[model samples]
Target: MKKNNSFTIRKLTLLIPGIVVAILTLQSCQEDETTELTRDEEIAITENATFSEDVSDEDIEIANSAEIEAGIQEPASRESSSEKCYATTWDAATRILTIDFGEGCVGPYGRQRRGKIIVSYGEEGNYYVADRTITFDNYFVNGNQITGELYVEKAVINEEGFYENNYTVNYTILFNGGTTFTLNGSRKREWIAGVLDDNFANNVFRITGSLTGISTRGISWSHQIVEPIIADFNCRSEGNFLYTQGIKEISYSNSRRKRTRTVDYGDGICDRSYTIAINNDLITITAE
Candidate 1:
């Protein structure tokens, strides 16, 4: 009986270590799964954010040109290489400016676009100070359908005497692959340079904003611009429209876990290189 009791105790002691090892392994896997952000996820978040900026840039350009052409503002240089496939019509009585892209056209950044952008204003003034509501009509950019409204608030001059325009955004992007991401955010554009020269290409803006969205992959994410993004339209980089420099932090959560990543767009360089840091791993991706 003594021998049997000793044997039972030994057996129990041997099983305890195995149980602990199993538990530790399981926990390690869970931590890895929850804390590590895959490259695909990082790309998705960045691209979605980029899409918003790209659209906003186009909106501003079109509205600015329309105001100039409609005799509302002084004509600025319209030097652009984008194929002209759109017709602009302004109704003074209705205070509406319509940009119709018949069929399809390759835009400034080499994106194919088809549809109309309807800009309705409160009064005949520059797009900067006037209350405006921008909506899209059957708009397809780069084969991806975009639906949204950008409400441009009245601009205010800062101490630097530059116009600062704010926009409230609510947009949904349906990718060509049938996936989708719905984004809601606000963006503030500060005309930092070239306001006096009136050259559209030389215009520089400092953009700050935040966005929240949920993707079709069931990932909920939010983006906060930690550093003011410098967008130099003249410093055109390969495969990138604007946003020449800045830093942003993206927080995302999925069913398994939550994680955060930082995106650095380089030190004000004119290149398509950005770095994503997640879980202590840094990856550089070139925009294409």
Candidate 2:
């Protein structure tokens, strides 16, 4: 075959599908054909590279596990497929994450702010990319003075590989430490977190559970709205915010508003109740 060894990458962008096919055929024939490569062929193959050089074990794992592949061709061996790295972590499964701003982040001024922080992960292949989502939640204005506790509510890796979280997000701004916000209903990022930062108005971040769907992350504004990680836990016994074991009824209290959180986990089984207190925007749901 008179191989036109010269190929512009951009042009090969379309030619790749065909090239991949040819390469697959050659690789299968390698058992009979000598693995030795002519100097020119080796150089051409290296020059026409498209994938990342530093392919990791995860990349190999996904590609090898593509049993339900689009094209019905027998998958090439991992050693052979290692070089053609056209893989990603984008999957169909949705991940749910609940971010919490710790105690230090919710003292006097910090506690005054209220709302929700939606976290999400883009799926690649059949599984969710765990390490791919390593974002810094810009907390320290000076990288010294802290803010609050960014608690993680839920992060489960499903069969198809995606993290899923479903929760209610608040978008109310309280001026004083004794102010209040409301979780009356569901609202988009535009209506809720938008007031804080214009970017939050779009579907950039995602809320795991609330029927409204996921949202995007945005800049936090003080005047318009303040975002806070809401935690209404089921208190096993009482007073134990950091639950260990045998817990009982739930309790929570947001700083600004004295709102009642109807935390009915299911069908009247764990359908318990509790009184809430809005001390400084912290919804301390004390158990009865």
Q: Evaluated with TM-score, which candidate comes out highest? A: 1
What residue pairs clash in candidate 1, if any at all?
Answer: none
Off by over 4 Å in 2: 1-146, 151-156, 159-162, 165-175, 178-248, 251-262, 265-288
Candidate 2 lands at a TM-score of: 0.16
lDDT by residue for model 1 (84-137), tens:
567888887888888887799975456688898888897646567788998899
For residues 1-288, could you state the per-residue lDDT of candidate 2 as single tens digits? Answer: 665656655677888899999999877666323333322322222111100100111111222233113231132221222122122232234542323232223211112112222234334322122322221233221112221221222335445443433222332212133322222122111112111221111111222122111111111111111232112122211222211111112112122221222221222122233222222332323221
Q: What is the C-alpha lDDT of each candidate?
A: 0.76, 0.24
Worst ten in a row by lDDT for model 2: 48-57
Q: Give residue 133's error in model 2 in angstroms.
A: 10
Which residue ranges in model 1 land beyond 4 Å of their true spot? 1-37, 75-83, 237-241
The candidate that wins on lDDT is 1
